[model samples]
Target: MPTIRKKGEGQYHVQIRKRGYPTQTKTFTKEVDAKRWATIIESEMERGVFVSRTEAEATLVKDVLQRFASEVLPTKRSEQSDKSRIKTLIEEFGNYRLASLNSTQIAKFRDQRLKVVGPQSVIHEINLLNRVLKTASMDWGIALPGGLPTEQVRKPIKPRGRDRRVAELEIAKILEATESLELRTIVTLAVETGMRRNEIASLVWDEIDLKNQTAHLPKTKTDVPRTVPLSRAAVKALNAFGVKEDGRVFALQAESMSQAFERACEPHRANIVGARFHDLRHEATSRLFEKGLNVMEVAAITGHKTLDMLKRYTHLRAEDLAKKIG
Candidate 1:
């Protein structure tokens, strides 16, 4: 049976049903909208079609996480990172219904999250939330219970465009500061491999192949495996680091390593111009191009997915560019 009734004010209630199908009902404020709904329902049912919006909205965030755990996690090169991000989503928004998420709440959430984490981090968390909702709506065909207009909720940018590289001499100063043999290896590998401090600290011994001159960088910022050639400097440094009987590389936490590097460069921080440990990557890529390696070779070593990202890292010297032309 199909029921048509008056709802509050201008609203009309319409429920369309047929045997062997779930009932579909919707509220409309206009007779034209009701007629449109009725026509679409009748036309679709005549063609023997069905979909469920209510059941989809009823599903939990944990259930939605299954998509990430099953489809996304295994393929991710950085298992540790996937676990961490998933944990954040689970802790912060696990109980909230995907369909019921809205921009007003999301904005407040971003603002509050920024107080605890950095603006960069809050932006990242919001991006994660957006991804989850997109999957729920597009992949599962679930109607939004309270849809988000994400732009309205975003905080003002906190001025984040950093491209830092260690100057040759300061790089020397940092090396001397970290006199510990282990710390030296940490600094050496970072300079040569241009790996993020976290990725370098996360390196497990089993992934390194000395004979093949390749170290399998399974953990990275981009969550992709990057095979770094064992430059002689990097090899010498690692060998000096000596092997830990265990699988891990550094005994220290990743943050600890970054802190050590930061302390080493404290003298230059007065005018560092947005220098960060990760900017070693930009430095390494620049040096490679300076030494005459082509873009393709640089991309292979840096694990950049596109020339666009690679360009961001590639800062050719004026002399180097002239050499190419001249």
Candidate 2:
């Protein structure tokens, strides 16, 4: 049973108590509404499906996201990227109360986001939102409207894998435009070894073994340490760039390097409209295949966990294959 008392100004306070459950309380503007809520809550308790909605109803999405950003994001490996996506979510739904969050609203957000960004970006954002809601429901004891709304929302189609190999002429233009020796060397290493830009930029001198012709990465995006066998070109680039015994290989930040690459690509933008710094990885992977290396061999170099992932990067041209056929 719920104890109902009239608080001044037509407000009624109701508190429901049951065995083996914490007392739940709420204030209603109407006495009838108070009685109605108590009946529903007591019945739910009897059926063992009751959840306290006080926190969820009182807290806004902005507060939950802020708390997540401060407490949870810092512990993540992809913290920078996670923070960026969480910030975007906050900007969109910060004012919404947690209790009011629902599938229809989330679907509207997804549809709207798809107009401006790619499907992958929207997917990442929605996934984070789902994570936050789950945490609130399970850990914070916040009652959600139902199961995660992300399940009901339609996700955009996954985009096709990019196969934009850098053409010789485009490569020439990029190299020519790249006056910085550091950026030049990074670009060369990416094409020659098929290593990601961050992997190349973050390399330390100790990770490189010029004598053994291998670079040992202690950590990579795949969360595995992979020793990339250095090609003759890779070794030559490393030698020309020079190395210190126990320091970073390149004195560059990943974002700055990416920006520099983008600027270098500007001159040949008309020819390479969709080219990105990452396309160099694709180019290098395809080149490895052209050199007659099998899928397993390429996977070893690229640190692809599976052959399916490696195949996405390997885009061999028909003309090249036709010549080999003849």
Candidate 3:
């Protein structure tokens, strides 16, 4: 049975209760509208098609983002990136009710986002929104209409893989220009081991086995543990730097290292205009292939989860390959 009560100012409040389903209540301006909703809800409940929208209807986009950040992101290796994207989503759509969001509105938001940020950035943001909505529907019992709006909108094209490899002379200049010994060692490690900046920054002494010439990475961007085989150069760098008893190998923040690296490269800004620190990994991977390492062998050292990903980092220079051909 559905109960309807008239509230002040031509308003009617309807509350519906079914045996198995949870209680649902809503306020409508007209009694007829309230009655229609009640009838539909009651019918759905009787047919066992009722899904509780109470939480979804009441929850704002911002609140759901907060919940995801707290409940889910903590367990992810990509937590920081996910949280950053979640924050962007909340800033854009925080006030919108989860139940009221539709593809049209989300598409409009995507258009607006495209105006300001690059395609890759907007794509990442949309990806995060879709994941949140997916979790809400599957895990939280929230009934959002029309599914993920991101599915309806035209996604941006995937950016082409970067093929920027640092040159040997440029590498020498960068090595000489770095302000700190730790930054120099860190740069060397990236070039020698093909480790990502965060991986190198987060590396600890326990992860390194100088005797065995391997470094145990307990967590990587792929959320997998991999043992990176240390090159003779990498081992020599570690030995010269001296091992810490048990802390991070380099007390370096990834962002700080990036800033420092950019500063070091500033003097050669014209020559290496678009080169990034990550290009060191590309250079390193290409060097491994040039050394006659097979795809699988290179992937093992690079911790690339797949050969497809490893390929992105193996852009050898034509001149370098030509020398080998001769």
Candidate 4:
């Protein structure tokens, strides 16, 4: 049923030839191991459940990651970030064969990465690795005999969400400190509409409908298009700049806006402790809740896919709640 021959010192080669199936061959260090492998392959063939793992055994993780980076990563909304992660993965796992990847190796990688990076970063890397493996298996027809290793590895615990909210005094200080009218306007929009820094930075005149009091975002972090209802404050801020039919609302890029905000807050760090530009979105969401907007209503405006995520961005003040209760 199978042929076993000694190729060299400590090298035993086994070949299995089935009438209905393709020939399977492997080389092992010991004759016993070679025989055992042949028996397993023969049993699977007899049971009609045999699937060749030849390609998977031969392919390296580096090659798959390279292919994925070229073909799949470009199409993703987070292509740049994904490319960075893929590069890291290739550096770590490039030498290992696809079939050799296992839960033990993945668990070790998770633990090792946790030492250098935060849990969330490790989680993202592990999730990306899983995505790459699944793509290899499902799309590329690579059959992993050991299954996906990431499925069995225990993921690190996610850190608690940030509850930072900017106070009215701090907001005023930040605005007053910044001489740039454009940065001041961006800050105002962030707090009023709960729009992310990127969304606000990438905004165009055409996306805004002053008559309807709405800003249409065709591209968002969630890749879901949403129309943010504009407050009178938001509208007035936009009106401060003369309206054009179509063009970028602000000249600043996302990174530049963040850097400018950081610079603006540098002088008042004592008062604006731990406050980031993203905190403006949290402030806006909390205000919406205070205004009696329901969960669904706030989610629609903020483009949050889940209530849990929306809750993370909303931090209502005790004094405000007490006033409402009274």
Model 3 RMSD vs true structure: 3.3
Residue 241, model 2, lDDT: 86
TM-score of 1: 0.70
Question: Candidate 3: where are CA atoms >4 Å away?
Answer: 1-26, 31-50, 268-272, 306-308, 319-326
Best candidate according to TM-score = 4
Point out where model 4 deviates above 4 Å: 6-11, 18-21, 46-49, 268-271, 323-326
- Clashing residue pairs in candidate 4, if any? none
Better of 1 and 2 by lDDT: 2
Q: All candidates' TM-scores?
A: 0.70, 0.82, 0.83, 0.92
- The lDDT values for all models are 0.72, 0.86, 0.84, 0.90
Best by lDDT: 4
lDDT of 2 by residue, 91-114 (tens): 988999887788899898899999
lDDT of 3 by residue, 225-314 (tens): 889988888898888888878988887798888877888888554244667888889999999999999988888888898777887788
Better of 1 and 4 by TM-score: 4
Tens digit of per-residue lDDT, candidate 4, span 1-326:
99999997999999999999999999999898998989989999999988888998999999999999999987776788888898889888999999888999889888998999999999999999999999999999998887899999999999998888898888998888888889889999999999998889879998999999999998888889999999998899888866788999999998899888888888554345677988899999999999999999999999999988998889999998999899
lDDT of candidate 1 over 1-326, digit per residue (tens): 46778988998999988886678888888988897877877676777664545655577776776676667667665556556766777776678766555677777777777778887676666666666667767776765634544544756475444556678776776677665677778877877876767778788888887667678886677777788887888888877778654588888788787676676666554233345677777888888878778988888888888987788777667876887899
Model 1: residue 92 alpha-carbon error in angstroms: 8.7
Stretches of candidate 1 off by over 4 Å are 5-14, 18-21, 25-51, 56-97, 100-119, 137-160, 244-246, 268-274, 323-326
